[model samples]
Target: MNRRLPTKTIALLLAAALLTGCGAFSNDNRVDPELSLEQAKQTAMAMELELAEMIPDENVASVDQSQTGVLLSCDDKRGYQWTGGMNIVVQGDLDPAALVDAIIDRYSTQELYTAKSSPTPDGGPGAHVIGQHGAGYLVNQSPDRTAIEILSFSPCFVLPEGTSPRGNF
Candidate 1:
């Protein structure tokens, strides 16, 4: 005769295995718990300096604080048809991959939101998440930094009726 485990016992075993495999139940506190808007601005400013060096002709138009994070915009000195901007979210030193995963998971569960892994502009790996409202987020993580950049367009800024606004990527 064959002996089988009870249904409840099997379910418990499966849950345990999943939790352990994904470390979802583990108390690993590697992520930084406190991340403030001021700190994020500082980080974004530094990043902007680096970007300036890369593109000497363009200048940062503005830096402003938003409800969720900071915003940085590139000036349209070249009289370009579109304006480009970036929204930054900085969290203190944390595992970038894990942070990206967490954000993706959080958005994936929401209605009208999509999240997926994307390749960074520099050929590095990153995450890209978007909402139904035309707002989008791009995340990149390094050893010392974790940041999310939002790319959005203002309809009023576009001219000629069909030009697409530039992105901060």
Candidate 2:
């Protein structure tokens, strides 16, 4: 016997599948209504700067910053995650391994921060650490090892009704 589902039923099933598969129901990307998009970007930038300061001041010659907005997932039609990165150029030698250890030590006393150094595929030192409100950073080294980047991300949030995600979508 040939059996076919009704069009309405098929549409409902498709919607359910998309919502589940696209992480619409996942709380991993928790939305904070109180966090505006601008506030999220600021949080990310400030955290990145704080993490960068973990390195010695004299060693840091200069810094550059970049920020971007990203959607949580395919299901996230309106929600956005603010990502920020600060590139630090060192005047003297800056040891990433030592810095990672220093960060771990610094955050140990802080209740909101937890830090750990991860393993890198290239056998170089890797770093991943978390701070308050799911704010975190991944330290990336330049291939030439002359500059270090503090790649940071903010918690997922939606822009308030009055705000736009950069005046573009």
Candidate 3:
């Protein structure tokens, strides 16, 4: 004769699965509020400068963040229309060539989409990190229908130590 599990066991198993999928069992459920445009820019710049000083570098040349709001047109009323974003760029200095390789190596394991070594007009080695994310299209004209994209590009001589790396979301 075949022996089947009790009804209570099946019910408990289903409940546990549902909780796991819904993230209800997560330890931390807090979400940080969104930052204003000006705040975001300032915070990003400070972080960039901090990173620049950590590595072995002479000085940070420039640190800037760009932000943009865009509205695209779609063929249908519910068609896909994505908003564009701003790009951030940062430049700095380095004495020994090996330090450049070290920074790139660490960044390779981060949230960076693309990292490449390029040349600057002033005869300096420029390293860049680029990332892109789709905000998705809206199905209805909801009040919260805007998407903000943050891009940071800081080529620092020295990177910050003991400081966790952060990027735009």
Predicted structure 1: lDDT:
0.34
User: Over the stretch 1-169, how does candidate 2's per-residue lDDT look in tens digits?
Assistant: 2122233432333343233321223334556668876787788777778887777888877777664534332125556666545667776877878877777677756876666665343455646666544455566454446666665557556655555556322
Error of 3 at 109 (Å): 1.6
TM-score of 1: 0.35
* Local error of candidate 1 at residue 131 (angstroms): 1.7
**Per-residue accuracy of model 1 over 62-152 as CA lDDT, tens digit each:** 3222322222222232111111223233434444566567766766787855667654434444555443212333444322233333322
Give lDDT for model 3: 0.28
Judge candidate 1 at residue 16 and give its lDDT: 31
Expressed as tens digits, the lDDT of each residue in 1-169 for candidate 3 is 2122223422332233233321112222221234233343344344334334444333333323233322221222321112212212223433323434544455546663333442222233333332222111101001121211122321111112443223322
Number of clashes recorded per candidate: 0, 0, 4
Weakest ten-residue segment in model 3 by summed lDDT? 134-143
CA deviation > 4 Å runs, candidate 2: 1-28, 67-77, 160-169
Whichever of 1 and 2 has more TM-score, that candidate is: 2
